[model samples]
Target: MELQQMRYVIAVAETNSFTRAAERCLVVQSALSHQIARLERELGARLFERTSRRVRLTPAGAAFLPAARQCLDAAERAAAEVAAAVGEVRGRLAVGLIPTVAAVDIPGALRDFRRRYPQVRVGLRVGASDDLVEQVKEGALDVAFLGLPTTARLTGVAARELARDRLVAVVAPDHPLAGGPSVSLGRLATEDFVDLPAGTAGRIQTDQAFAAAGLTREVAFEVTTADFMDRLVGQGLGIAMFPSASVHRLTGVAAVEVTDAPARVEYVIWSPVGRTPAAAAFLDLLDLPGPGGSAAHAARAALGTR
Candidate 1:
């Protein structure tokens, strides 16, 4: 019934350890347990199933988690709205970014945002695009910059395209394709490739493009970071593909345009529930028009700002 109880439950669910959750919430283990017990008793449902090794959410807990997050988001938005009325943006803003985000100057934007609202606390989380999108939907992140297909349809999230960058082939300067203006996927079918691991946004796009072109390459190395991939290609370990903007400044690698390759679109996505004043201000820094109009206006309407 109390807001603190809801927060405790959410913390426990996220950490899956009562001790760690209590530590994160800045409370004693016993007090956190007691609060959760009281909340379970009030609801007449077991929210979590505890065992010796791990704590797992029950079916009821899984179902209640979204509503609990929405309650917290609504409370934060209400508080932010009151502060925004006074032309003040002071709140925690959690933003997520993909590892290979290159189309936007995120660091520069953050620098500007800090100068504009020094009181706002900003937290950044870096991960793959899919992971970032899930975090935004779960309310763990207020906004996320993701690399996605141009036609990507994300449920429970509102996304707006920021910029699109063409995918290009990267190779060592001495490689056979390095001197070429552009290379076809079919030309590299038999070549060794350094690629992102499967399930990442970049890998998925690369795979789809190859599949569409009826070409397959041997993956000699799988790397998680773009810089690592570039280094591998520079060493002649294998050819690789990445966004043109990301590979333009590499020293030992040459980025050749990929003939007929699909472009990856960079999108800024957020939960549709609402945005805190700090989050809205950060979006304003991006100057992105929402799917309909101004993203800031949409956020204000969602937050019930007057």
Candidate 2:
């Protein structure tokens, strides 16, 4: 029932070993066991199944885990809010971003954020844009950086557009199109392509462009990471369309402008209902320019600015 007991339970559940959990919690094995036993007695159910070989959560423990986590998170957030009221921002900041994020240097930004808010713990997750947006909406992430085709729409979250970029065609140096003049979508569509997995935001942007152009293309290779996509292109496997800003950073591939290409908008999204103090501080550090003024004003206008 106590917050400390909940913390101990989480540690045990995560480590799956009472001895390891005790080490993780910086408590003796006996004290950790005693506290968990006390909690089980109060709840009138055994939380764990202890055997000579292993310790695992019982059905009741599994059912109680999520609620326990929520309660602990709530308590921590409350304490963080109290500290923020007096000008100290100390909390966990969970930030999610797409792999091809170019509008802001993520590592640099994290460095600056850490320097400015040394007390805050920051965690980074790299994922697809749609997944990151869902995490933000679900409150699993405090904020997220996303890239979506201009034609796409986002709902139920507050967002600020960071930048807009046009995708360029990337080809191997020995390929036919390398070093050639800018190519049209029609011409590029004829070539094999290496792209992110189907249905991903990055892939969908190019797909929509091709569809709009009355064209269809083959994605010969589907890879998860941009590095692998670059490797495939360098090996003459296929061509790819990626943000123009990032193409220059890739070696062994030549970038050709696409006459008719897809454009993606970068955005930073957060929950409109519960804006954490740490998240607010990070947003302020960005100091992004909105359509008319600061990013703060633009986010208030929702997706209407973009």
Every candidate's lDDT: 0.82, 0.86
Task: Write down the TM-score of every candidate.
Answer: 0.82, 0.87
Candidate of highest lDDT: 2
lDDT of 2 by residue, 223-272 (tens): 98899999999999999999997786788999999988899999998886
What's the number of clashes in each of the models?
0, 0
Please give, for residues 116-143, the per-residue lDDT of candidate 1 as tens digits.
7787788898888888888988888988
Per-residue lDDT, model 1, residue 236, is 94
TM-score (C-alpha, index-matched) for candidate 1: 0.82
Among these predictions, the greatest TM-score belongs to 2
What TM-score does candidate 2 get on C-alpha atoms?
0.87
Deviation of model 2 at 277, angstroms: 1.5
lDDT, candidate 1, at 177: 91
What does the lDDT come to for candidate 1?
Answer: 0.82
Error of 1 at 149 (Å): 3.7
Scanning candidate 2 in windows of ten residues, the lowest lDDT window is 290-299
